[model samples]
Target: MQRLLPQHVRAATFDRRRWRGLDPEQVYAYLDRLADELERLTRDLCTANTEGERIRQALRQWQSRHTDCRHTQVAPNSRWHR
Candidate 1:
């Protein structure tokens, strides 16, 4: 679940002078890549949450269906006396 920079973005030391020298196009590309990654991560998290909810609901239903009921016993001598 670690976040990483998109493949297109190179990992390099950001010297102020070098950063300032980069072209506008490169900056725009980096921003676009980051946006795409963020969107994908958001979608993945939402799907995971939904699946977890479904599993929890299923488990609850199964537990309810399989629950044990209390039973009472009657003595044969008591019935015969009655």
Candidate 2:
């Protein structure tokens, strides 16, 4: 099943009952609040994903640049250590 999104909440409709129906204004207000919150959370999630990707890329680059150095070992009797 597809997950409900902010747009879905905003576009939701309900049938009205002539005898005992819910107040349309109240329903709309609640939907608006829910949609706004969903929108904010979605935005935050996107930003977090972008930042995570950036960090991962940086880490990969750093590892690539340092992999060789990390594998190199220093000798105790090297010329520079004399």
TM-score of each: 0.56, 0.85
Highest-lDDT candidate: 2
Model 2: colliding residue pairs:
none
Give per-candidate clash totals.
0, 0
Candidate 2 per-residue lDDT over residues 45-77, each given as its tens digit: 999999999999999999999999878877989
- Which 10 residues in a row give candidate 2 its minimum summed lDDT? 73-82
Off by over 4 Å in 2: 75-82
Residue 73 shift from truth in candidate 2, angstroms: 1.9
Runs of candidate 1 with Cα error greater than 4 angstroms are: 1-21, 69-82
